[model samples]
Target: MGEWRDVFDIKRDSAPVEEIAARIDADSTVKGANLVILIMAIFIASVGLNMNSVAVIIGAMLISPLMGGIVATGYGMATYDMHFIKKSLVKLSFQVVFALLTAAVYFSLTPITTPSPEMLARTAPTAWDVIIALCGGIAGAIGNTRQEKSNVIPGVAIATALMPPLCTAGYGIAAHSFHFFGGALYLFFINCFFITFSSFLIFKILRVPVCGGVSEAHFRYQRWFLIVCGLVVTVPSLYMAYVTANENIRDSQVKSFISQDMDLEASSVVAYELDHGVLIVDVIGAPLDDQEIERLQASLHQYGQLRQTTLKVVQGPASQLNQEQVQEIINARLANELKNDSGKSYKELANQYYGSYKRDAADQNLLRSLNRQAPVLFPAVRQISGGTLSTLNGEEETEGRQWLAYIVVSRQLTADEAGRLQQWIQTQADMPVVVNIQLQDTPSQFYGNGIDWNP
Candidate 1:
């Protein structure tokens, strides 16, 4: 057993191409079995990534049909087997298409548009990935040559992880983002080229004999063909890597600047967005004074990349900061002006005078009453009785009068309709019973302001 293990181990590191070809040819059932496995694996992988299930995704990788395709690709290149090449290409293409369709269908049905961390992680392939593929392919080829293969095949599978790109491609199709397609396809090409080429090198190392009439001329022709293919695949990948690096560099610069210069804690930066020519920094924690703003501007100037800097300072959590607060403040000032000018409450002035109904129900009704105008339509609410009612008796007998706080919610009002509403509400009878006119904003549009409690 010890001698057999030693012999097997030696063969494992030698003559990879012949051994892999022999293995495939020896088992007549391999083609069908592999095809089925590949299909299942791709489908599972697509679903895993779409659902963002890491465990399922790894499982898919473990049993991926990618290795067969890669092996076929190597066989085709090393032995000049066009038939094998065509077969492998067809098999791989079918698997990828199926996987992509499956993933696309899943994503289309699901409601997740923003990419998960795993999805985003696979987008940008790097130079290191090429190195890993080269090494993995070498190990895989060496192991395949042996009678008793080690765990190298599994390691290669996990390392290369070809299913992810195809899965991402499906996500792109579903999300209607071709950028994802571009990135994913690039990754696929990277895997194909490096692994195939590495296998070619291994075959040559193992002294796999070449076809006789596949002459020097044909060989040279094939070499040029491969070189051209390599160039075609590599240029875009390089460009993507550069772009990713630049983005990383920009983020690092921004983070470093914030850490070094700002008086506030770096953790306080709730949302920081860097665009092509501008940096929009939103800090939500405490309100910033003018002096802090000046210092921030000065620090930003040192970076010298940004054409414009929009600094938004809010009090509370960054996520809690209502970006629309500035707009609301403007609207509030406008409401105050319209009310003052019209000699009415804000709601009345907007509804009756201007006929603007763009404001929400709460703002509109309140402004209307302030403008002394009656709303065109009154909203209905639950009637709760609580007040004392006078009973009809010569002795002045008293009974409890039902008291209910009436809630009147108005729809969105435009400026012109708001003015008219204000004016209209002003003409109604002022009864002290229980009438509450509430203007309610749409839930989607309502962003409450964050006030600083620390100060």
Candidate 2:
């Protein structure tokens, strides 16, 4: 038990140059392992990023040789080992290159072009990243001081999270995504700087020896090197800090305005996105009533300058809505109704109630089966007697065997429009499938009157 605790403590301790150097040189095969592990790590990282697999990404991070380079660099700085510094830099650069090249090649070969959620996630860095890096660096330093490395390696792997950003960079290369490149590279740089600098601090604090006798010239050289490294790291940190501050300000303003103007009686205003300095709001149903519009405008005007506030409103009909949006609206309304007794979300409720059309997969299969068995030409030669199949309850019944299926369209459709639709459906086939048409009555009513709910 004592031995286990000590080993754990060693894994959680920080290190000096001598200790780190001994560890690096102890394993005769470490250098060779470094090369293989790094390449594999980078490839895994890229795949994980592309697929948005968090577990795969973490596994890649665990296998990455990145921490060794940073550790070596810090050790070099502390002990003034120029050879170690060069070796570490070369190894780190190779790892990075391998990762990037691997990503580029993999993505080029893989047929999937769509960005996975993981890929999208790594496309941005936030202040929280800085916090994570800082904490990780501190923990890494502690782990280094320990003799047992059970926790150190895992801690370093988790804290560094090196694979994600590198993989992100690879995604950029593969997908021609400049945004991915910039964001990912920036994140990688952040990790590199923090890890190396933190290690440097930990070493200096532990009073790691400089190997040779202290000379004024050597001391001055070391001081200058430290200063240069500090400058290099600080530049990006400061820029990231500024960006984080700006994002926070914009987010605060948006939330403040939305919260302050909750009294607006306008049609439900759904927040879509702020793009090109415009807010895209989904206004379900018809345009808001005059009173509702006035209330909305009045409330908005009080919160911010209304001159540049371009709000793109989208109006939709209940009949046009598919099941997903209808259900979403229903859920939103239900939540609102549960909170407020006025039932302001009743319009959404109504939309959901009317829009809930149960689509049957089996029906689609049946249509496909019928279409295959009885190849009918659209614009089926219609006669006055009984030439077309009727759709009375939103279901089409037909045993079409001709070039096209003759459909009895609803009377709501004009002859010209019906002919055009038949022509359109016919075009999908190689041979002309003429649709023979007839007029029939449908129970469903067209709904496009007015806004019914307040969001």
Give the alpha carbon lDDT tens digit for every residue of 324-352 in model 2.
67556555655554333223334443544
Which parts of model 2 have CA positions greater than 4 angstroms off? 1-19, 26-30, 213-218, 241-271, 289-291, 301-308, 316-455
CA lDDT scores, all candidates in order: 0.61, 0.60
Question: How does residue 61 of candidate 2 score in lDDT?
Answer: 87
How much does candidate 1 score in TM-score?
Answer: 0.61
Which lDDT tens digits does candidate 1 get at residues 168-213?
9888898888878877877877887888888777776666766545
Residues forming the 10-long window of minimal summed lDDT in candidate 2: 381-390
Candidate 2 lDDT (Cα, 0 to 1): 0.60
Q: Count the backbone clashes (under 3 Å) in each candidate.
A: 58, 29
